[model samples]
Target: MNQPHTAQDDGVRQRQQQIAANLRALILSGDLRPGDRVPSTSDLVAEYGVTDKTVQRALAILKAERFVEGQKGRGVFVTTQVPTVVRASHYPVTSSEEPYAWIADNASRGRAGSIVLLHVGEVPAPAQVAAAFDLEIGTPVTVRHQLLSLDGEPVELVWSYYPSNVARGTRLAEARKIRGGTPAVLSELGYPPHHAIDQVSARLATVEEFIALRLPQDMPVLRQLRVVFTDDDRPIEVTVMVKAGQHFEVRYALPKPE
Candidate 1:
C-alpha cells in the first residue's frame, strides 16, 4: 500500500504554500514594485502567525523563480529585470527580405535582441546531431554556438551545425559573429533554407546548462531541435536550442490535413 501523509506534515506544507502564495500575489500584481524590499522575516512571521523558517521557505520559492533577489547585508527585493519572451523554432524566420535572419524572435515584440557568438570550430558530430544532419557519428562538422540575450539577460543557448564539406571554406567556418545572419550566408552559398523541422522536448538541465542558463538544479530545460533543409530536402543546417524553462513559453501552429 502507498504511504499516507501525516496531518502534521500536511499542515506544514499548506502553511508554507499559503505564505508563498500571498507573497507571490503581491509581487505579480505590481503591489510590490521592482526594487521594493520584501517583508522581513520577523514581519512576515508575526503577520502570518508562522515560524521564521516558514517565511524563509516562501521567500526561497520566489528567489528560485527569480521573482525576487536577495542582497548582501540587505533584504530581498523584487526583481528589477523582466524575463525575455521568445518564439520557438516553429515561428517563421524573419523573411529573407528582412536582410538579417539572425535577429531574435523577441525583436518582433520590440525587445532588443543580441546573439553573442561564443565559439566556432569543427567538432565530431554527436549521435543525435549526426542523425539530424544525415552524417555518420564522429564525422567532423563545423559548429557555431551562441547565446541569445534580451535586454542584457540571457534567454537561450544555440548550437548550429553544418557539414564539414559544406562549410569548409565558407564564412560559416569562421570563429567570429556572422553579420546579416546564417540565411543570408546560406543564400550566398546557394543553400537558402526552404523548409525546417522543429522538435521540442523537456529534460533535466545538464551541468553546463545549469551554469550557462543560470537555472536551478531542479528546473527543467526546454529544448528545441531545428533542422533547416534546402528545397531538395538536403539538410544544410541543424540548430539545437535550450532555454531556462521558467523564462519561456513555446507555442506552435499546425495546419489541417490536406
Candidate 2:
C-alpha cells in the first residue's frame, strides 16, 4: 500500500517547481548571460528558505534542461545558448593531417582546447571494445585517452582506439613517437579514414568516471561515440568522448541538396 501525499508535501513540491521556474526565467531573460556567475547552492538555500537538498533538486532540473553548467571548485554559471550540431560524416586523413588537429580547429571556433593526456598505451581489447572494432576477442589494441579543457577548465574526456594490426609495428604503436597526432600516423600507414558515424546519449556517470571528470556528486554527463571508416567502408578507429553536460555543445551544418 502506498501512502497518500499530504497538503504540506504537495506545497513543498509546488514551491520547488516554482523556484526552478523562476531561475529559468532569469536565465532566458538575459539577466544571466553565458559564463555569468549564478548564486551558490548555499546562497540559493538561504535566499529561498529551502533546504540544501531542495535547492540541489532545483539546480538538477535546470541542468537537465541545459540552462546552466557547473565547474569544479567554481560555482555554477549560465551556459551559452548554442544549438548543438553533430556532423555524421567521414573525414579522410591525409599524410599531412594530424589526428586531433581537425577537432582542435573545430573547438577553437568555440574557444576550447585539449588539456590533459590521461593515458595512452597498448592493451588487450575488452569484449565490447573488440566487437566495436570487428576484432577477435583478446586482440591487442592501442588506446589513447585524454581530457579536453575549455578556458583552462576541464570539459570533456576522450578515449580513442585502434586495432593492433593497424597500429602494430608502426610509429603509432609507440606513444612518444606519435604523441603529436594519430591521423597523421594512420595516413602514413595507408589507412586514411574518410568517414565517420557518431552516436550520442545522456546519462549519469559511474563512480570512477565521476571522480575522474571531477563532476559533482549528482551531476549527469553526455556521451558521444564515433566510428571512423575508410571510403571502402573499412573500420579504422573508434572514439568515445564524455562531456560535462553544461560546457559541451555539438555543432554542424546541414547541407542543402542541389
- Residue 224's lDDT within candidate 1 is 88
lDDT of 1 by residue, 1-258 (tens): 533422233454467676766776786567998899998987777677777898888888888778888898999999975544445535345464554454645666667767788999999998888998877999999999999776666768999999989899989999887666777778889888888888889998888878887774356788988888986899999899998776776756666999
- Which consecutive 10 residues in model 1 have the weakest lDDT in total? 2-11
The candidate 2 region of ten consecutive residues with least summed lDDT is 2-11
lDDT tens per residue, model 2, 82-165:
423434454433434444664556565776555577777788887757877888877889888777765565667878889877
lDDT of each: 0.78, 0.70
TM-score of each: 0.72, 0.66
Highest TM-score scorer: 1
* Model 2 spans > 4 angstroms off: 1-107, 110-112, 177-180, 252-258
How far residue 44's Cα lies from its native spot in candidate 1, in Å, is 11
